[model samples]
Target: MLSDFLHEYFLKLSIIVAVFGGAFLGIGIGLVMRAGAALDGIEVLALYTLKRTSFTITEIILGINIIIFSFAALKFGIETSLYSVLTYFAATKTIDYVVEGIQAYTGVTIISAKSEEIKHQLVNNLGRGITVYKGERGFLPGKFDVSADCDIIYTVVMRLEMRKLKNLIYEIDSEAFVFANTIKEASGGIIKSRVKH
Candidate 1:
């Protein structure tokens, strides 16, 4: 009977431990970020600006990277500077993912000509929903191309699903323009329930 009781509650116990562990990790990350933002008072200013305006955390990160890379390029060389750019991009994405939450949801926006096919795959195969925005798609800075109407598909998905979705998209339209960002919070929709036994 005791063995049966333990067996029955094992999953529950494990889940509890996992949740607590994640919470502690989150707290630790928060403290580290606070410390990071304290450096030279610039981070604090950036954080303040980020909190107030519509600017995303990524813009600030990329801005910092631009400065760092410029300095690195002068001090080191083009090779190290290029490597730093890649590293900075990865770090910024990671920070955005962490800052969003443990779940690390991502919002995907695809401006693909293969909208119907992509929609079908997402809805039927992946069981995901998407929002379509119909708008003009061209305004060139260099190339004088004529504007054309397009449908922009947007979907919110877990980070795990992001790669799969992107692959499916690329398989359909190789020239598709896709962008993704970590979502802070999501609720009340096709996003499946989190509660599990």
Candidate 2:
């Protein structure tokens, strides 16, 4: 009877450790959270990587989750892998929503014929500074026509400002080629003016 109790207790303890350990390691990526605890090991690793590198916390978490889930799938089965992926996503989203709200940034690039007008609007109207790179565009892959010189207007802005900026871009130059990418973070620039225009 005593031996049976010991065996059951050990088994339960092992299972508990396995489950909780995996979940905590997989989820607690963004370190130093609300419950008054400093990060260690994996959580700290993720947080540090996020701060120093271009990767976001969510991305780092997802990458780790994928690695763990891959190992589980190979050792266990496909069902476990799918379940783990879903669990990671749901937990990541919920935790991020509750703990750290989404940090959204957009990198806007504009190539326009009317560079002066666009620059004026972006500076005076939007109160945004832009970096212009002189480059040759208009070289179609299919055509042999020579390229035309244009200024590559690049700026990083809050996602909320994208729509307004886009409208202004189109209004200024209907034929402007504009593209945007979701960036992880932006710093050390006149990202936004304190004095609203």
Candidate 3:
């Protein structure tokens, strides 16, 4: 049996085995879900609970996992249960990463006086599409009565490109106010550059 084989060979390295095994299992399950298929009854049960209860799918699943692990701890030794918990945690995180995507996207907002130059450079250098919003600036304690029009630039970029984007923007305007948010999902935009072979 698989259990016996793992116990015989990996008993001493249980933690490592659990983590790797869980990661591989999570990848498989995530890919199946992404393809619009169910891998186990837990997913089905979660879906059923989702409609009748106010709890989200993740909450339902977590609740179920807690119950299952509690029972596991009661039946198995504490050490075994702890290893199982580690495996479960790794698997859950791996599943999220796999399902969401390895190449994460970040939504960036830039507020700058040199908006025109920054926008041009962003498009020409980064090949990213930008959305501009007209807004008022200079709203300080004493300057609340006075304001100036400005352009707020927004764009989505891959996580790997964040440093480059920051450098580029700061190079253009040292005083540019920039912030970013982690995007769960992004679509229907010029997200990918058009590459020619």
Write down the lDDT of every candidate, Cα atoms only: 0.71, 0.73, 0.82
Candidate 2 local Cα displacement, residue 136, angstroms = 2.1
After TM-score superposition, the amount by which residue 175's alpha carbon in candidate 3 deviates from its true location, in angstroms, is 4.1
From the highest lDDT down, the ranking of the candidates is 3, 2, 1
Model 2 lDDT-worst window of ten: 29-38
Instruction: Name the candidate, 2 or 3, with the larger TM-score value.
Output: 3
- Assess every candidate by TM-score: 0.49, 0.64, 0.71
Which tens-of-lDDT digit does each residue in 44-155 have in candidate 1?
Answer: 6658778887776656756876787899899899756765565555555555545665566788999877788888887777877778899777756776486788888888
What does the lDDT read for residue 177 in candidate 2? Answer: 94
Report the poorest 10 consecutive residues by lDDT, candidate 3: 54-63
Top candidate on lDDT is: 3
Model 3 ranges off by over 4 Å: 1-12, 46-63, 74-79, 138-148, 194-197
Report the poorest 10 consecutive residues by lDDT, candidate 1.
Answer: 21-30
Give the clash total for candidate 2.
0
lDDT of 2 by residue, 1-197 (tens): 99999989986775565556545644564334535343555456667787788776656766787888899899899766866676666555555544444446788999998988998888888888789999878666887576788989998777778889999999988989999997755778787754473
Q: List clashing residue pairs in candidate 3.
A: none
Off by over 4 Å in 1: 1-101, 139-145, 193-197
